[model samples]
Target: MSLLASGSLLAQGSESKEKEMEAAWQAAQSSAQAGPATVKLGEQATLKLPAKEVFIPQPAAGKLMHAMGNLDDERLLGLVLPTGDDDWMVVAKYEPSGYIRDDEAKDWNVDDLFKSLKEGTEAANEEREKRGISGLEIVGWVERPHYEAASHRLVWSMSAREKGQPADAPQSVNYNTYALGREGYVSLNLITARDQVDANKPVVRTLLSNLDFTEGKAYADFNASTDKVAEYGLAALIGGVAAKKLGLLAILAAFFAKFAKVIALAVAGIGYSATKWFRRKPSGSAEPK
Candidate 1:
């Protein structure tokens, strides 16, 4: 074949591979919510993997880490999985933090916590720079730390943009909630475009409600008499301790990009880059009717 013809064929082949990868990614996501499954979340809790939603149990979580990228987390239980049912969907992850105390919740101030997060993230950026990763700037609270003392559940989010991105650039946020048990807490991480938190919250709420603490492991069973309490309190989970892990949360972006054939379909589905999925007027929380 002529040199010109050979180049054209190579270009066509590259395009074909790209299209194939996209299709495979879509098919994997569509299969997520296909078969219902149950994953035992440690000895304390259980997750109900509803129909059509994929659930990666802890055993296979390593497979994901391999496919996605290096996630610098040690407490990772597993990802709750995302369904390709919407333009964008929230990816929830579970991490078990054994028996944290809520005592500090009373004395904690939201402003102080915010300051710590800012300080901690700014400090983390130094390390990120050393590693050649882009710095992340905290844009402020999407949802301030809200702890439900009664249920032992906490929900909070921070708006973050890649350093130096345009003000209105699409962003990423993690709306985290925890189901505190007698042993440790189970963290539910909802990762998605910062703009789609509202659209994806109902599903998040459902997932939180459905995560059940098995017998002898419910937070109510906390036997101060016999239970082992974590050294950190609820405040640390939000303020200092959390800031470190929050720095690495952006790996989800790298994860999607690395496997642009699978979860990356949100971009094509919405006619935008994967980063800009669910572009809309950003809201701190779901707008009221």
Candidate 2:
């Protein structure tokens, strides 16, 4: 063939290949958007799985499955499985916040909490051994950090539980604790009844897994700021009343302080209303009120 003819043929082949590749890509994308099918594990129970690779089991009969995702940290997922018998299973995926500093009392307290949890596990194991129970095991302790914004505090929780307990039997529980700035603080003996412990794990795990620690910063800051505002509001209210009673500048200051938030809120509302009104077109005909 001539060189020009050969070049033209090659170009046509390349264009055909590109078209095929584009078609294949589009097909794959469509399939991905279709999502996974729902599967029934037991009577009246169903599980929804994503079209992606993960293949989680469908829930069994009489079990309710709950799932929540972190708003900021999309990677975190929490699942709660509540069995009708009051038994629960919780699964969480996310690192707890904060670290245990050596100088902090909270650090030492957390250590003691873990020690107590271990003791509880050992005791439960001993009891199981004495009873010659098979398949009974202490699954060790799990700890995570929980933050309380109201107090600007962080709690390190260490939980211990016995696994493979009979469905009807009580579960063994032991826990350790630590606070953000406190040390060597041992918590009181808090025990979970066997049945209750079994029932709570699923819920707790689900809650943890679904938590979005990344998005929590805004909420934490909002809470702290709001507390200060509330304090000021209360003071302003009191001062306003007192000033009115005493005939002092308290009334002016009180009025400004007491209504600051309300006034700001009203202004914001009015601005929003005006914007909406401006964007709307007038109706052609007036309707009767």
Candidate 3:
């Protein structure tokens, strides 16, 4: 083929991919539920999402994540994006791994936890390299793991960058927050650039507070006689448990440049009205209006 024809075809292919990505973004926004709404978050919990933000519930959410280069996760309940200048995202997932004991949280030493995470991430890098994803190194904790016994909540943050990356290279942060439930835990991870994490931390915390497990699903309702317990404890959730998950969360930064335009347009004053889905709620909670 002529060089001119080959170049033209390559350009067309790139344009086609961009169009497809933009289409996915628009579809997700069209279906997104604007906040100040009560919506079901999987079978065990509800989200009282606030206004000026939108929640892209599943199926559509899963497609958008795939387009954004994230691996498929059945546990993904939905995604939250803002309608303002906060260029960040919150990924919400529900894991029915059974009750995760939090007793270990009290005994966890920050230094020990950091060591475990560093080692675990180094191991996870092997898998990333095998898949052709850039190897990442933990830059250190943005926020040390903190657990609230009374609320059954946990919060932590970490930053990572490509191995051998210059010290001045941009870092990606994952500000993770979790709400423990009788069946398992619900996690809301805020994905943003390192420089933006401090400003967006409160945003994710607000969403965490808005998540409520249905009656009988609260952590306090665990029936020790009949309920199943997770094999790992809270400490594992921070150390080994987070290593694989962090790899995926970290990769999100690499693809932001590709989809930034579409995302910016969606969040730029677009009206994302609320939409209801088939929610499974226990008897005590009020039905979606």
Candidate 4:
């Protein structure tokens, strides 16, 4: 072969090899970053690197703002939130399934769970109205199942607006809800104002792009350790046993001391009701013999 032709062929071969290597590298990085797909509620999928990472249900609003600063990427999913002026945006990463598989216990159907959530939303709206506030306006809701060879994961999402004045009409708010192990995690994001697109769009995009289907590491960082019902029940049982052995007043006093605020509120409410009842009755009226 001629010298020129040989050189050209060698260059082409080198370029092809380079391209293949790059593609392989990208695949490896993606796999490494997205560890496993299955996680229970309250579990988190963390990134390999520790650079400026923020967990869902991040500690402070200011921290979230800082983590999202100056990020510009468009391929990410934008979760919009409601604001008085314009909608705010947040990006989501994980899609979870809602199916629960328990052979001994009753299994919850995905469709039924969704129906229950819808009912809850309606009830929330009614409660708002009772508080003399405008009702909630929901934009959309998303539910998807994450599947693996052996099991499935459930995820839920909803977007809605809270009460606002007529002049300050409701805007959008995006909610991303999912279960990791047995714990639930929710990520919220606010949409940007119309005029502030330049400042907010890039942040929204970057957040979405960084989000993927890999197992999330953020869940471990923030969930409460014990289940409230189980913990409280155990405490009550122990206390009851001790009270039976000792004296009821000591046990009752301990309980009241532990839940002073709750008891105080209940007492106050009862006192107010009694006072109203007594005031409504006629002072001169005899007992209904």
Candidate 1 Cα misplacement greater than 4 A, ranges = 1-37, 72-74, 87-96, 241-289
lDDT of 3 by residue, 1-289 (tens): 9999999987786666555555556567567787789879988999888887888888888877665545677888998877665678888888887999998887878887787677666666675666656677888899988999999999988887778999997777778899999999998888877887898899999989888999999999999999999866786667554444444433233222222222233222222221211122324544322
lDDT leaderboard ranking: 3, 1, 4, 2
Q: Which candidate has the highest TM-score of all?
A: 3
Candidate RMSDs in order:
9.0, 29.1, 8.0, 29.5
Residue 248 accuracy (lDDT) in model 4? 33
For candidate 1, lDDT tens digit of each residue in 1-289?
9999999987786666545434433333332332366667666687776664555444344444333333444555655544444533334444455678888788878997777677677666665666656677778888888888888888887767668899996667766677888877777766666667887666667778778999988988878777787655777657554444445423223222222122344322323333222122233422111
Candidate 2, residue 177: the lDDT equals 22
lDDT of 3: 0.72
Per-residue lDDT for 67 in model 1? 34
Top-down TM-score ranking: 3, 1, 4, 2
- TM-scores for every candidate against the unseen true structure: 0.70, 0.21, 0.80, 0.29
Error of 3 at 75 (Å): 0.4
Candidate models: Cα lDDT each: 0.59, 0.28, 0.72, 0.30
